[model samples]
Target: MINRILVVCTGNICRSPTAAHLLREALLGCDIAIGSAGLGALIGQPIDGAALATLECHGHRPQLHRARQLTAELAQEADLILTMEQGQVQGVIQRIPEVRGKIFLLGKWQGELEIPDPYRQGPEAFEHSYGLIERAVASWAGRLLLRR
Candidate 1:
């Protein structure tokens, strides 16, 4: 019954978008909708160039991803919300208290490791973060696909 997933991070440009697209690719042909947002987004801005490059390296086609701010409405719409960091889970819950049980760390299934933000850091940082996101997505995708 998990129809929609929302990935969250500090800025929509980096971790969240990368995770979102990867999740979408992982769940290919499934009836689930995936999206991402930021707690304090550079609204309407395109995904970070480093992030786009990292995704391309991993075989995911880059898209014109525009940053969007996280809102209560988006939280309400998502069947499950995944955040790049533990702190982000609290941020989302604070904004939408009703989404308590539905929000989780993207790495929850992998020992709860937090995916670091690579915004403006450099290619190395982006690459490191991308590795973490990839693993997290794989873990979640496995569980999701099994239930379907």
Candidate 2:
């Protein structure tokens, strides 16, 4: 019944966008729609170059993604809201109390791991973030696909 998912991070340029792209690829052939947003986004900005490179290096094609701030409307539309860190769960819920039950850590199933922000850190940080995002996306995809 969960048809739409929103991935969130501190900024949309790095972690969230990367996860959204990977999740979209992993969930191919399924009916779900995936999107990414940031709690403190630099709206209208493109995905960080390093993040894009990391995703491409991992065999996933990066989209022409632009940063968007997390909005109440988006939160209302998403059946599930996955955040990169625990603090984000609080941030989203504080903004949209109706979504309390639906919001969760992106790595909740992966032992509640928190995906770190890799913006401006360098390619290595981006690479590490990508690896974690890939694993989290794969885990969520497997479970979501089973529901179909």
Candidate 3:
């Protein structure tokens, strides 16, 4: 029943987009629609350089990704909304209370791990965040694919 998924973070340039791309690949051809947005997005901006480099290092071509702000309509359209941290879960609820039931931590299966932001940081920080996002995406992919 998870046909639509939205990944969320503070800025769309990093964690959320990374998770979305990885999830899209993990759930390839599964009829799921994956997207990402940010609570305070640098709207229309490209992914952060460090984050982009990290993704490219993993063979993912996310060059076309652009940052987008989270909106009520987007949240409403998603069947599942995954956030990078617990605060983000509450943030989504504060903006769109109706989405409360569908919002959850992206690392729900990894002991509720919270993926950190690597914006303005060095490659090491971006690499660490990417690692966490990868693990969370793998865990969610299994559960989501099973629902389809």
lDDT of each: 0.92, 0.90, 0.92
TM-score of 1: 0.97
Clashing pairs in 2: none
Candidate 2 per-residue lDDT over residues 76-112, each given as its tens digit:
9999999999999999989999999999888989999
Q: List the residue pairs that clash in candidate 1.
A: none
TM-score of each: 0.97, 0.97, 0.97
Q: Model 1, 14: alpha-carbon shift in Å?
A: 0.6
Lowest lDDT block of 10, candidate 3: 139-148
Query: Residue 138 of model 2: what lDDT?
Result: 91
Tell me the deviation in Å of residue 72 in model 1: 0.5
- The C-alpha stretches of model 1 lying farther than 4 A from their native spots are none
